[model samples]
Target chain A: MATSHTTEAVNLPSAVQERQRRAKFRRNMFYLALLAVGLVAPFVAYPVFLMKILCFALFACAFNLLLGYAGLLSFGHAAFLATGGYVTGYLLASYPGLTPELGILAGTAMATLLGALFGVLSIRRQGIYFAMVTLALAQLMFFVFVQSSFTGGEDGLHGVPRGSLFGVIDISSNLAMYYFVFAVFVFGFAVIQRTVHSPFGQVLKAIRENEPRAISLGYNVDAYKLLAFVLSAALAGLAGSTKTVVFQLASLTDAHWHMSGEVILMTLLGGVGTLLGPLMGAGLVVSLQHLLAQSPLGNWVSVILGIIFVVCVLSFRSGIIGELSKMYRKNFK
Target chain B: MTMIFGVPMAVFMGQLTLGLVNGAFYALLSLGLAVIFGLLKIVNFAHGAQYMLGAFAALLGFRYLGINYWLALILVPLVVGGFGMLMERFLLRRIAHLDHLYGLLLTFGLALIFEGTLINFFGVSGARYATPEILQGGLNLGFMFLPTYRAWVLVAALAMCLFTWFMIERTRLGAYLRAGTENSQLMQAFGVNVPLLITLTYGFGVGLAAFAGVLAAPLYPVSPTMGSSLLIVVFAVVVIGGMGSILGAILTGLGMGIIEGLTKVYYPEASNTVIFLVMILVLMLRPAGLFGKEA
Candidate 1:
């Protein structure tokens, strides 16, 4: 708007600003394209499968918020996820008149509380100890789930009616459910996007890069880490809650250590630090699992998963999106 | 029969012994974890898988190759420790220079591979290994009857834990390991082969897990998942004890196991979660762990 008038006022580094603007433009374009793809995805493929991917994708993204940005690798994130699912399932099953959204909200809230508990205990330790503490705490929760009558024990908390959204929109239909999940995914994704780009995210990144340095720079390192951990757990819970609503079941598998491990694989395999990396990772892993589960090689899915983990850690450390973005930055940027 | 806490004394004592036996397994497993972590700075996530391998190895050998329980005890550790050494040299060594979490991740993958392959071959229904004739039958007490094999497990685990403690705390080889842990570069400058020591340390640490597995084979079903499940509880024990002190791991393991067993008699429901509850309490009071120095 002021191309000529403001130009002579100061050397504004307009070229650098222009480059940043172009980058933002390209990023927005990519987002719009992705959103467009997501919109038509249910029509092109099965709605149920798309919803599953979206739920887990949000989960991976939530997990990435901790491990990638905050540099806190929680080995028990499944605790939060399962907490959300079970709470939602229980509430829905108990309150026949309760709306689906409220049950999901309740689940997410419980998960956030769990995240706080998990963070308070495990955040004290660093590196390997932190992972171990988280895993231990989650196992504790797993036992609770196993013994609790609310969980229905080995049979799992089942027969959860999807009900109507807000008692208004009947979302039990597959397409309706897909859209509902998509909306929830977008909201969660938006929250993550905002958090990552905000100044808080910058500080979290700093802490991840160098905690001592961040501490020296006056950041409350524990508080930051705890906040990040809680946020990640809450989002993971949200994913789990939505998943239960979609599937109408909450099983013990949701809270198992393997679930925790699977989330890490998704984040690592997709790209640790990148924005869209987890989504891509979740998509691939979920699809791979689905395909393998249906095939004769189904029994060996875990072996393949382990092989993927070894390969990722040993060689593909940057993951699919990480490498792709690296190339894009090198060439396109 | 006398009643203690409103339960039959025999049942109470039986549960206590069972708890203590479980604790022995915990002590053995966590001791290996502590030893390995001391040198590698990596939590061997697959230690549980290795323990499972030990059980399967012993069981399969017995079933097909006529390997006796005693023979399996001696052989399984060597075989599993050899496997651990190879893992260190190849998969683990590659990521040694990266973040310690990568090592955890790699081991976790290896754990999955071992667990997955085992479960694939032998479905979840576990196989049983009869206690050897030498340890068969039961010991009659005034209260509960104690299985001879169970008593032997307690004895063997005690000997193993004490021997490990002595080897690490009182011996010259342990001195080298301690020195290496303190500063590998300094140890290397002192003409000790640090890398070789590291490899051996990992092997020995994992050998402890294998020993526990072989010991466990007769007690529990020779299932693929037995180790992975118990591994988490040991992790709790490690967190409660802190990961540094071998003695701490042993004591905490036994104590937690006993507490768990008592809980089974008293509340029944909380037995599975009691150790974790203690862990939470410990984390709140002493973030460094009960035995860990404040970091």
Candidate 2:
């Protein structure tokens, strides 16, 4: 009797089933296209530049995963970024005979661990309280890094070598390094996309839209939040580790609370929930900085960035990709 | 004549006095933050920049107008408060209906603009503003040497905090302000000028920061970077004390300041971060903060 009931449930109208299947395939194709672009774009851009973009894109994406999807704003994301950067820099620069791969892993591991620790303490509060808790925790980490001898105290850890990737590939070459970063970014991006589309992601969205309803449905809301937080932190660490490798140095700037604000700005500038938004946002921000390097307006970057944040928050809540997606959806539908 | 807890009495007294001086600024700044946050529901990230602006205003007054310390104390807050009013009128008023986070983002933008402008005009090395000759000397406390200016600062800040507290917590006008803070719509129905009150509340809060700036000018070297450094510490203060009650803000500020000073005497390395450490401990024990209400 149970088997017959299950079979009946599975047997749906063919047209409705076909539409669902086509939608699933389209989403998968979108992911594949994104992966392909992330992989190929490095060759077109400067390798180092590409690496920077990937790392920040990953960071912004991780940040959006929390704020956009989970409906939590974390003001202290630099804690994870700094932890990852410090771990990688310390290992590559201080320890002898460490491969780049191992260094990256070490950084990612530290960030993951720290993220879990913070997530437990932070998820207790909602909205503004959550933001404040994160900021306070991150500020604590900043002080620790500033005072610790290993971080080189204010002067920062300098002269880090771009060690060989697993003692084989020389990451010194621009093209070679680009491909390595591209591969890592794609891996991270794919994981995020998968996680977001899974049953877990659906639960997260439900919680974001209306927590009481999600709770009423017998979901362990807090646990879902914690899981999302850890994932976001680990991805952010990946970005930070990649950045350390690309820059060949780790400094106080990486750990400074201002960097946390900058990441939020990047996520906001890009459409928050859109997959392509962070990538485009990262590209825009990084390229802006690159251009600003030669111009007199260089000093005003923070001001301009801040203005963009205010404007985006006030007027363009959906962000660039979000707006674009709306047009696309209207036309296609 | 004797030592207590194996520490010299003179040294202990000195630390206590120093703690009081630091506490004065803490109380003043946190009070301003609480007022601003209470009414606006925004943290005002640019507060530090405005505090710095207050110091700069004093410095400018001294440089060009030959204004003395006392005159600047009165004039600067008015000036800074007026500037704050203008900011509210032009920028902040436009985004009041949106999420409060927009306020933070906008203020953050203004902070960058102000800081960047100051940096462009006056280099990052920082400039100095000297204490006026009248308040230059120290007082003989018998147990410890107390600078007259420092003592004055403590007393002045205490008075100002209390006066502001009394104004907001006691008076009829304060009741209206409190009512507006609680429910602007209800207050509007009662025929209160809610929007005007908001602009003034913001001005009053910014003016409080400027007032602290005047108090701080004599103790710390006047610099553009001063406010940001102090602002972060004040944020930690707000987190620990919780912005729930004005009394809580004042007490926690003073208490944390003393704790920080004592830490300096024992373990100087942790002194810089003891407030943050205490904040973490507070979060662990009581996430609602010592006096904050659950949102």
Clashing pairs counted in every model: 0, 0
Stretches of candidate 2 exceeding 4 Å from the true structure: A1-27, A330-332, B1-4
Minimal lDDT window, size 10, model 1 chain B: B286-295
Backbone clash pairs for candidate 1 read none
> Model 2: which docking level applies?
medium
User: For residues B170-263, could you state the per-residue lDDT of candidate 1 as single tens digits?
Assistant: 9998999998888988999999988899999999999999999999999999899998989999998998998778888899999999999999
For model 2, name the residue pairs that clash: none
lDDT of each: 0.93, 0.85
Query: With candidate 1 superimposed using the best TM-score fit, by how many Å does residue A199's alpha carbon deviate from the native?
Result: 0.8
Candidate 1: segments with Cα more than 4 A from true spot: A1-12, A331-333
Model 2 Cα displacement at A204 (Å)? Answer: 2.3
Q: Write the per-residue lDDT of candidate 2 for residues A1-333, one digit (tens) a residue.
A: 346655864798888778878989998898788778767776676777778888899999998899878988888899999889989999999886999999999999999999999999888777766787788788888989999998888888787788788898888887888888888888888888888877788788999889989999999999999999999999999889888988888887877777888888788788888877888888899889888877989877876777777788668878898998888989998
